[model samples]
Target: MTHLPLAGRRVIELGTMVAAPFATHILSQLGAEVIKVEPPTGDTTRALVRGGPSGTFIAYNHGKKSLSIALDTPEGRDVFRRLVASADIVIHNLSPSATRKLQITADDLAAVNPRLIYCHIRGYAAGPQHDDLATNPVAEASTGVMDDHRIDGRPSRLGPSYHDQFAGAYGVIRILATLLQPAPTAEERRIEIGLYETGLHVAARDLAGVQLKMQLLGRPEKEGGGEFSMPGYGAYQVNDGRWLYLLVLTDAHWQKLATALGMPEADDPALAKLRERKKQRERVEAAVRAAVGKLGFDEAAERLRAAGVGFSEVLPLERVLAAPQARQPGKLRDLDYRGLHFEAPEFPGQAECSPGLPPPELGEHTVELLRGLGFDERACAALVEQRAVAVAREGDFAWAPVRPEASGKA
Candidate 1:
């Protein structure tokens, strides 16, 4: 295995929920020593599900150490300051007031370690619009992203927390870029990314298309006109009620699609040109929809494949997991964390593969980490006794297969 780019770096992740954890998860995969600091109650996601950590929590918190500390206590704050002083990067997604309350702001950490790269991920920019309680879905709705994804005038959120994930990815990129530059000054070390702005960044291509269409039509984008429309690239329902998405990017693709659907308009002079085909979008769409509707799922899939058309069945999660693309080595890997074996998604272009390290249970490494930080065993015990910190007393790692009886009956 190749050495990961961040092998020797230490990161303190003061994050909860998705965005910040997602960022640190990437860092952990890149071989960074990511220490996730959670409150004594543990991450909010851990309690979201009844029995244990939800899938969301596990997905974003894997390959990291957990330190459960009570930030409201002076001792806890002191411990965090010490950790930040010894860390290379400090990242968090707490609200503005939460940062002030906990005193873990970028400025606060920078005071202890001037060279530390402190990144703050939030749901909105530093302005009046930033709601302290805003979440991923709220941010998406506020950013017009949900409206853009409307189907028949009813706005719908994408299945996943798109903005939260995008913000995390952007945070990682910004952190990497900052690390590559000359030694950052105290002021230069702080970076802020808002979910709303990140949403706009992710929609650049679509926005560009909107802009071009507005320019061509000589209208303003916000004035209720100007949508960059495309034809022959959408989903059509078959006889069996399965949706088949098609991508006809070029004229040849359009021809192939038409032939695949057995549409008689293949040699029609009126639709020969790409512009003409686009102009007749409604007619073309109706024809394709009708053709696809006539065929069953199997026949439609076979004909589409035979025609070399870019298409796919709109598969559910189970089908997607079983697909060849999902089975690729780097795309997904079987993890044996403790004893629970499951497949986890792996990042592309990762140098050091994930070691399948399970996410630490709340405060699972508190004692060990405190000892590593030069605290004596007695001092660590005192902190735990004071309720300023919590440490797991059992084995460091354990996985119990959820028995059927655990659901309700013994």
Candidate 2:
């Protein structure tokens, strides 16, 4: 097997929920050894589900070691400092006050290891709202993402935590870029990613369009941002009750779709142009709706496929796992948590490759990591006795299959 690019690197992750953990998750997939530094109680997502691991935790936290430490204690701080001294990167999503109180901020850790690349994912960049609390939805709302996705005239959140994931992806980009610098200075190694800024970036196209219209065209921004004004570019229900999203970006696509659906209006030369089609969007959409409404999902899909028209059935959350695309070889990796087997999608570009170790149970590697840090058996016991560090006990785990129906099957 070829050695992964980040094989020798070590990342100490102090993240909860999504952003920071997800960043390190990517690093792990790329072959970095990620040591997740959690509090004694473990990451908040661990307990979200009543039994077994929450999907959120399982999704972003696999392929890493967990070290449960109470940073409030001196012993725990000493352990973390020791870990950082030999670490290449340290990332966290803790609040400013929390980092300051725990003394794990970049400045503090850099004092221990100047070569450390420290990344902090926060709610905002350095500004008036730098210290304000922010979650995925909050960032979305603040950056106009929610406004752009509004429903019924009220701001609505995107179903997934897109801002958090995007910020995590950006974190990986920054870390990888910094790693390329030959002997970066301590100041240069420090990285900060703001979730709000990431949200703004996600909504940049709409924001730029609005500003450009106001500046150049002397026109007000549209009431509902991000809506597709083009006909045949939206979702329509078929006779089988399945929704299909049809896109007609080019005149060629429109021609193909019209021919495939047997629309009599295809002969109109005026509709050959995109601008002309937009002008008669209602009529075009009505034709599409009427044509689609007569066909079942399978027939419509077959016709669209035969005609080379771009379309996809909108799969609900429950059906996504069973979708043909998802079931393709190498699309997902098998995982077993306390005998509860399940599958998760492979990280991008990692298909058909090893996905490393499963997510460590809370403090699963505590004693092992401490021993590697040069702590003797007695010292390791002392830290555990003081409640400064925790080790995973058999009693702490339960075996409740999250998806029993899919268990023991390929």
Candidate 3:
């Protein structure tokens, strides 16, 4: 193992839910120190108890420290400013108005640290409709991604928070790109990524296909079949009811598949060329499906491997985790944190000496983090007493109802 790339970097994450935390998760895995700032009630995912912290929260918030503060209070805003002053990057997905009210905008932080990379992730990009309240699903629908993926005339959302996760990856790319600049004194960089834009970006391949079809045929058609519908490139159920997706895109692959399935008619004159094969798509699909469906899982896998066909079995989450590949060295580690044991993925080239940290309780690091910022013990205690900050202690609960903001506060 080698030292990770972001060993000394510091990141302050100020958003909840998936996107911002996901960006921090990637940073943490690369050895950056990520501090997550939360309100006194903690992130909403903290209360989603499914055996422990919700899987959604644990997946993104692990290895990050939590500091609970009330931004509506002047003291809390001062503390956040202090954190930004010494930070390398600050990321948040708060709404535009919320950012204005909290005074955590790019300009606000750049005044504190000129070299900081301030990144904002939102549901939509800036424009006349920039202030609309957007979520993961809404972003997907608005971008036409959902409609483009309609199944049986009904739009379907991708299983995961696809738009949010892609936006997070985009955030990481923007931050890293900013860090590559030569420094010694420079102005801050501001980047804004929208979930809707990310959704479109990720579907670039599909979008290109649609445009190409429209240009060539005067109208777009469904995917998975175009000028050539290679029957092998789809999911098929085996005799044992297991599903496997196969890929045989080239003529050579098709020949190999033909030989493996003992389907001599696949080489008939009418199906010799790709365009000809397209004309007989139903025949090809039916033939391939019948051949694959007759074989049991092991037999189908062996034949596919022998024929050099690219394929993968569809496995459930549990099976995916327990698969042989997951147990190999440098793949995963069984980590015990916060009274729970789970398999943690090992980032490529991460140092062998790296230690995993548990998700923090609400306010777990408030006092210590503030102390690191030059606050004395008395000041820390005073802030807690003033309801500007919260600190978790043994046998203590920091849970509190969020107060309605003052007329001018947010």
Top candidate when judged by lDDT against the true structure: 2
State in Å the error of residue 196, model 3: 1.7
Pairing residues by index, what is the TM-score of model 3? 0.89
TM-score of each: 0.88, 0.94, 0.89
Instruction: For candidate 1, write residues 265-363 as lDDT tens digits.
Output: 877879766789778978887887898999999999899899999998999876788888777666765666546676778887753354666878889
Q: If the candidates were sorted by their TM-score against the true structure, best first, what order would they fall in?
A: 2, 3, 1
Best by TM-score: 2
List ranges where model 1 is wrong by over 4 Å.
126-133, 208-228, 296-299, 337-339, 351-354, 393-410
In model 2, which range of ten residues has the least summed lDDT? 220-229
Cα error of candidate 1 at position 182, Å = 3.3
Q: Go through the candidates in order and give each one's C-alpha lDDT.
A: 0.81, 0.86, 0.79
The ten-residue window of minimal lDDT in model 3 covers 394-403
* Model 2 TM: 0.94
Flag regions of model 2 displaced more than 4 Å: 223-227, 397-410
Error at 381, model 1, angstroms: 0.8
| Cα lDDT tens digits for candidate 2, 1-410 | 45789999999999998999889988987889999999987898887765446788888888899999999999899998999998999999999899899998888998999889999999997789989878899998888777677688888999888888889999999999999999887777999899988988888887888898899889966534222566777788999889999977788988999899889877889888878987897898899899889999999999999999999888887788888878876678888876667788877664475645777899999999999999999999999999999999775545455477766641
